[model samples]
Target chain A: MATAEERSRLRDVPIPAIGGVRWLLGLVVPALLVVVWHLLVTTGVFAAHQLPEPLRVVGTLYAMGVAGDLWGHVAITLQRVFFGVLLGVAVGTGLGTLTGLSGLASDLLDPLLQSLKNIPSLAWVPLFLLWFGIGEGAKVLLIAVGAFFPVYLNLSTGIGEVSEDLLEVAEVYDLGRVEALRTVVFPAALPSLLVGIRGGVGLAWMFVVAAELIAASQGIGFLLSDGRVLARPDVIVGSILLFAFLGNLSDLAVKGVQRRVVDW
Target chain B: MADAPSEPTLSVRGLTKRYGDTVALADVDLAVRGGEFVAVVGPSGCGKSTLLRVLSGLEDRFEGRAAVDGDDVREGGSDAVGMVFQEPRLLPWTDVRGNVAVGLPADVDAADPDARARIDELIRIVGLGGFAERRPAELSGGMKQRVSLARGLAYDPSVLLLDEPFSALDRLTKHEQQDHLSDACAERGTTVVLVTHDVEEAAYLADRVVVLGDQPGRVETVVDVDADRPRERTDEDLLAVRARIVEALGV
Candidate 1:
C-alpha cells in the first residue's frame, strides 16, 4: 500500500519525465537554432531586410493576436487536424485490426498500403487539389492521407506482435472475442498504438503546413503564404514560429497520453 | 507386491502431435493424481513444453485424449488450467496487482474488496507484497516470475502448468524459487506439472519425475520421489533420485 506521501508523489510525477526528456531534447535543437538566427539578425550579422529581427516577429504576433487573426488561423488549422486525425485513427485502426485478424486480408492489403505509404504525403497535394478541388474537403483528405499510414502500420504491427502465450491464456480462460480483445489483445497492443499516434501527430502537423501552402484559403499555412506574397518577412517568420510552437506542443501532448496509457 | 491405486486426475493415453511430417509427442502415456507434483524432463527439443501445452489444452491439434478430473480436455481452458511461461509475460502496462488479477474473470471486478484482499495475500505468499505497484520492467526476473506464479495462483486453479518457469533464473535464485514453490504447492494442495531440462530440479521438486526420450518423445521411465515433504536439498534420497534421472537420460 502507498503511504499518503507516496500517493501524493504519484500525483506529482512530471508529465515530461513520464513522456521522456529525449523528445524534449529533440525540440531544443531547432528552438536554439531559431534563437541563434534571431541573435545574428539583432547583431547586424545579417541584414534586417533579409531576415527580420526576433522583436519584429514578436511585434507581428502581438498585432495578429490583438486583431484576433491569430486565433482564427489557429482554430481553422486545429479543426482540419482534428477531423483528419480522428477519421484516420478510426479507419486505420479498424482496417489494421481486420488485417491483423485475417491472414488473407493482411496478405492482400499489406503490400498495397505499404507501397502507398512510401509515396510521401506532400506528393498527393497536386492530385488531391485536382480531385477534391482545393477546398476544405481536399485539405481534410490530404491530412487524413498523411495520418492514416503510420497509425495503420503501427496498429497492425502491435496486433501482430502480441504474444501467442497470451492468446493461449485468453483461450484457456474462455474469453469471448470482445473480452479477449479488451483484456489481452487491447492491453498488449496499446503501447504500439500510442507509438503510432505519436508518429501520426507529427505527420498531421507536416500535412497541416502542406495543406495551407497548397490548398487552403485560411490557416497558419495560409498566413505564412500571405506573409510571403506581401513581402512582410516579420509575419512569415512569426507564423512559422507559431507553427513550430504548436507542433511541438501537440507532439508533447500526444506523448503525454502515450506515457499514461503505457505507464511502465 | 500390492498394486497402487490407478485413478488419474490427469490422464494422457497414446497422445500424438505432428507438425506437417514431423511427429512431436507420439504414443506417450502418463497419469497424475490430484495434489501430485509431476516434473517432465528431457533433452533439448524433446517436446517437454509441447506435452505441457497439450495437457494445458493449448495444443488441441493433436491426437489422443487428455483428461482432467475425468473430463476430456477438448479445448483451451485458461480458467480450468493456469500456466506460467518460460518468461514472466506480464503485461508491462499493468502493475503487479493488476497483472495477477488478469487471470480472473474479466467482469469479476478486480477492485472488489474480497478480490483485492486475496490478491494482497497472494502477493505475500509469493513474496511480492512490497512490489504490488511496480511495473514488469521495474522488477527483476525472479520477481517477475514470482508475479507470474502469483497470477497463476490467483486463478484458484486445480492444476498449475509451468513451462520452464525458473529456467531463466540464476542457479541460486532457481534453488530459492524451487523451495518456495514446493512449500506453497504443499500448503495449497495445488496439482503442479513442471517442464524442465534440469534433472536435479526435477528430482528436487517433483513427486514423480517422468523421463522422456527425444525424436518423437516417449516416456523412458518414471522415477518416484519418495523423499519426505518439506524436503532438504542435501537429503541422500533426493540425490539418489537425481542420479536415477541422470542415468535414465544417459547423461
Candidate 2:
C-alpha cells in the first residue's frame, strides 16, 4: 500500500484530453458530398432544369421560410410524429413488458403482433385512410404503427435476456415477485429498451412520409408531392433534405438519452 | 431431531436434492450454533454449492428439512438468510449505495434515513467508505466482491450464506477480503454457512470445516479449528488444522 505522502505525489497528474469538437469530424463527408453536388451542376454534367443546383434548393427553402409557409408544415409534421411516437411507445412498452414477464401473455399476443409487424408501412395507408378518413387521425396512427414494432420487439427480447444469476440474487434477497422485477429485471433490460426506442423513432419518420403522401395539406411529405405536381425539382429535393436532417436530429437525441441511462 | 440437543441457528436433516436422474446431494445433515462460522469444503462437483442454494431458498425442490432461524427453508425461512453468490451478480445500472439497498428487508423503507445509515455502515465495514457513488463497472474484481459482501450484510439477517464468494480473487486480495469478512461477521456475531472448494480458506475462516464427499455429496468429516482470533496465517496450529482439512478430502 502507498503511504500518504506517496499517494499525495500522484494527485497532480494531468487529466487526459476531452473529446471536445470531435463531433465536427462527422460533418466532413456531408460537406464533401455537397461540394461535389455543386460541381456536378456547375460543370454542366446535368442541366439546371434536370437537377437544381444546391444553392437553388437552399434558395427555395429560404423563400418558403421567409414567407412563413415553412413553419406551419414543419410544426404539423413534428406534432404528428411526436404524438405518434408517444402513443406507440406507450402501448409497445405495456405489451412488451406483459409478454416479456408472463408466458401466458407471450403465447396469446406474440403470434398476432409478429404477423402484424410483417405488413409494409405503405400497405396500411389506404386501410387507415378508409378507417379514420383523411384527417390527422389516420396520418398519426400510421406513424404510430411504424413506431410500435421495434420497441415491442426490442423490449421483449431485452427483458427475456436478463441473466439467471441476477434473478437468483433477487430470490436470495427475498425481493418477492414485483420487487425483483423492479430492481433486477427492469434495470438489466433498460439498454435493449433504449435500443428499441431509437429504432422506433427512425421508423416513425419513415411512416410519417407514407402517412402524408396519401392525403394531407401539410407536413414535409406533402411538400414532396406538391413540389412534383408543380414541376419544381428544387422543392422535392429540399423536402428530402429536411427529412434527413430531422431524422438524424431525433436519432441523436435518443442516443444521448441512451448514453445517460446505460452509463454503467 | 434425533441428535440435535439444542435449537441450532441453522439445521439440515436428511437433505436430498435431485435434478431428474442425477442427485446433487443426498441425505446430507448438518447443524450450526448461533454466531458460528461453518465452511463446507469439497472438490468441484461435490454439491457444496447446492447445499448453499437450498439454504438460501434459491432451489425450493429439495427433499428434506433445512431451516434457518427455526423456519423451514422452503417456507419463508430464507427471509432470515442473506446470500452472496460466487459472482458479484450486481445490477450494472446502479451505484454501490443503490445496489446495497436492494438487499434491504421488505419492511425497511429504502428512502428512510435510518436505512441509508445502515447501508453506509455496511459499506464502511466492507472497506468501501468513499465509494458509495461508484458503479460496479468502475470497481476491480476484489472491490466488486466487497460490494457484494456489503450487500449480503445489508439486511442484517440472522444467517449469511456464502457460495465461494472469494474464490475468484487473487491470492493477496483474497486474504485481505477474508480478514475483512472475518472481522465484520465477528463484530455482528452473524451466523454463517460458507461453501467453498479451497481447504485453506475453510481453515482460515471457519470455526468448523465440513468436508463433503463427491458422489451425491455427504459429510466426510468435520474438522474443528478452535483457534484464536486474528490468527497468524503461518502459525503452527493453523497449519495443523489446514493439514487435517486437506486430509479429510482424501486427496
Candidate 3:
C-alpha cells in the first residue's frame, strides 16, 4: 500500500504549489459561496430543515466516513462505471470501424444508430429494466448504452477523414489490407478517437447516477435516494458534490493519457 | 552492387490513361536504360505526374504496358520500385529512423542486425544522422523531404520514381537536395525517373529529359545531356539542353 505522500504524488494534486495568487484565484468563488451559505443559515433566510448549514453537511460526511459507508458507496459506483464504459468502448469501436470501412455497413447500420442516439439515457431506463430486470445487468447496460454513441460517431468520422495522401503512400508500398489499416488508418484516426473516449467516459458517469436512482440498492445514487426518504438535505447535497469531484477527476485522467499518447 | 543491364530498365509503350472523359495521357512512349537518370518535364497540365504514377505501378488503369526490369509493373512489383511524392508523406507518429524503415520490403527481417544498420545508413546518407529519434514535426520542411528521399532509397530498389520531390523546397535547399540525390543515386547506380517543371533542374541532373505537351498529353521531345557527372549548372552543353527543353515545353 502507498503512503499518504506517495499517494498524493501519484494523484498529482500539486498542493505545495497551490499557495500562489494564481492558484488562489480558483478558490475565490467557492469561498464566496461558502460565506453566502453561512449567512443564509445564520440569518434564517430559509428554514433549517430545507437548507442545512454547510458545516452540518461536513459533519455528516465525517460521520459517514467514520461508519465506513462512504467508501463502499464510492467503490461500488466507480466499479459500475468502469465496467460499463469498457464494454461500451469495445462495442462502439468495433461497429464504428466496420461501418467506416464499408459503404454497405454504413448504409445498413447508420440510420438505426442515429435514431437510437436521439433517445435520452433516462428514456432507455424503462426498456432496459424490462429487458434485463432490475438487477446489475440493467444498470450496467444502461450506462453502456449512454456511453456508446459519442465513441461511435467520433471514431467513424475520424477513420473516414484519414488523409488521401497517406492512403496513396500505403498503396505504393503495397501494404496488405490489414497492414494498411494498422499502420496508416489507425494512427491517423487516434486523436479523434481519444476525443470520443473522453466524451464517452463523461456520459458513463452521468448515466450511472440515473441507473442507480431507478433500481440500485447500494451506490452513491442509492445514498441520495435514501437521504431523501430520511429528510437529510446534507446527504443529498454531499452526494452531488462527490459526483462532481469524481467526474472531474476522471476527465483529468483521460486528458493526461491523451497528452502522453498523441505526442505528434 | 548488381551488374548494369544493356537493355532499358524501364519501358513504356503506347501508354494511355483516362479519367472519366478527360484524357490524362495518350499513347506516350519512353524508355530509360539501366542506371540512367531520366527527368520528365512539362507544363502544369501535361500529365507528367500521371506518367510517373503509371510507371511506378500506383496507377494500373492505363491502356498499354509499363515494365521494370522485364517484369510488368501492374503485377505488383513493388519490391523493385520506390517512389517519393511531392510532399514528404511521412507518418507523423514515427521518427526519422522509423519512417525510413517503413520502406523495407515486407519479407525483410526488421529484427535482423543488418537491416537495422541499413536503416541507420540511409538516415546518415540523408544527413539526418543524430536526429534519427526526432519526429517529423520537429524537423524543417527540407529535412522532412530528406527523410522522404531516404525512405525511397532504403530498400535498395532497382528503380526510384520521384514526382517533383524537390519542387516544394526553396532555391538553396532544392540545389542541396539535387546534389544529395545525384550523389546518392550515382553511388547506388539505381535507375531514376524524376518529374519536374524546371528545365534547368532536368538538364543539370538527368541523362535525358523527356518533355510532354498538354491537352491530350503526349511526348513532345527527348533531349539528351552528354555532359559528364557533376556537370556545372552553367556549362555550355547543359545550357543548350535546358534551352531546347524550354522550347519543347513551349513555356
Candidate 4:
C-alpha cells in the first residue's frame, strides 16, 4: 500500500465577523430612538418634567460622570451582579449535576425546583428581607435567586441530553461511570452550561434592580429610585440607559467566552 | 497471561440479541485469533453491527457468550476491547490530541508532558499528525472519522471492534483510512473485527469475510481471502475472492 498521504487541512473557519457594519447596523435603531425622543421633547409633545429632552438625559449622565459619582453607582451594581452570578452558578452546577446524572435524584428534586421557579424575583423580596434584614446579604442572595434558575434548568437538560452514542463509546473504552461523566458527559454538556451562564448574568442584572429596592443607597438601581423620589426625569432616564449598557456588556462578555470555549 | 496457547483472542458463540419481540441477531458464532483481521459484511438489517455491539460490551443483554481471551466480556468489567462507532463521537470541546487521549487507560497521564508523545503518535498513525491541534468542528468528515479511529487505538486494546466505521466517508477517503487502519494494526499487532456493509471494503481489508443473512441475522458463510499483504485490489486472485464473498451474500 502506497502510504502516500493526503491531509486535507481545513483552514481556520473565520468566526462570523462581528465587524464594523454589524456594529454600526445595530446602532441604527437606538440612534433613531434617541432622535425620536429629541423630537418628542423639543416639539413639546410631552412636558419637560414628564419626559426630559434626550440631551438633558445625556447631560445629567455626563455631569454625574465628571463629578466621579457615576462610577460608584456603576461599580456597586456590577459587583453585586458579579458575586450573585458566581454564587448562582456554583450552586446551580452542583444541583444540576446531581439531578442530571441520577433519575432518582431528578425525580426527588426537579418538581420542587420547577414549582419554585415561578415565584417572581419580587416575590422572594419579602421573605429574603425578613430573613436577612435588608442588608447586602439579602440583596446579593435575591440576585442569586434570580440567576440560579437558568443555570439549573439549562445545565440539567444539557447533561441529561448528552448523546447516547458518545456514552456507548465511553463504555466500550471501559471508562467507568465516574470517569465517563468527567471525561465525556461534562465536556459535552458545556455549551449548554455556558448558555445558561449567559442567561444567569442577564437575570442577575434584573434581580439586582429588585435587590437594590430593599433600601440601597449607592447603586444604579438606587439612582433610579432616588431620581424617581426627587422627580428628576433626566437622572431616571440616564440610570435606565446605564443599566442597558452594562447588562449588554456583561452578556457580550459571557458570549465571547462561550464562542472560545465551545469552538467545536 | 494465563491463557492456553490454543485460545482465540476474541470468541462469540450462540450470541443472540433481541429488543422485546424483535430479534436483532440470532445464533451467531465466530472466533478470531490474535493479530487477525476479520470483517463481518451483510445487507442492512443483517445484524452486522449487532455482533460488534455484543462483543464490545454495549449489548450486554444478549444470550450466549462473548469472550475476550477466554473470559466472558459481557458482564461490563472488560477492558480488553476498544471500539470505533459509526460516528466520530468526538468531544467538541477538545482537540484531536485530547479526544484520542480520552481513550487512554485511566491511569495514564494524558496531561503529562511525557504521555503527549504517545498521544501524538496515535494521531499520526491515523494520518492526522499535523492536525493534532484541530477541533472536530474544524475537521472534514473523513478526518473526524480518523480521529475516532485514533481514539479507539489509544486504549492499546487487545481487540478492536469497528462498526461500519468508514460508512460515512467518501470512497477514496475510505480506502485511505482502511490502509491506515491496516498499517496501524499491523504495527501494533492488534486483533481487529470490523462490521461493514460494503463487499469491496470487506474483500480489500479483511483476512476473512463473514457474510450474514437478514431478519434474525445469522451467519451465512465465512470466506477466507488467502491473499498476501499489500495485495493489489485488481489482482485476479483477490477479484476471485471478492466474487466469492459477493456470491455468499446471495445477491
Off by over 4 Å in 2: A1-21, B1-4, B168-180, B186-189, B228-236
Every model's DockQ: 0.35, 0.67, 0.54, 0.54
Which model is ahead, 3 or 4, in terms of TM-score?
4
Q: Of models 2 and 4, which has the larger DockQ?
A: 2
Candidate 3 achieves a global lDDT of 0.87
The better-scoring model by DockQ among 2 and 3 is 2
TM-scores, all candidates, are 0.80, 0.91, 0.89, 0.90
Best by lDDT: 2
**lDDT tens digits by residue: candidate 4, B40-92:** 98889888777777788777687888899878886542578888888888988
Predicted candidate 3 versus true structure: per-residue lDDT over A171-213, tens digit per residue: 7776668878988899998888888889999999989999998
lDDT per residue, candidate 3, B103-216, as tens digits? 777777666788899999888877789989999999998889889988888766779999888876788878877898898888888989999978889999999999898868
The per-candidate count of clashes, in order, stands at 3, 0, 0, 0
| Candidate 2's TM-score | 0.91
Is candidate 1 or 3 superior in TM-score?
A: 3
- lDDT, residue B65, model 4: 83
- Clashing residue pairs for model 2: none
Error of 3 at B71 (Å): 4.9
DockQ of 3: 0.54
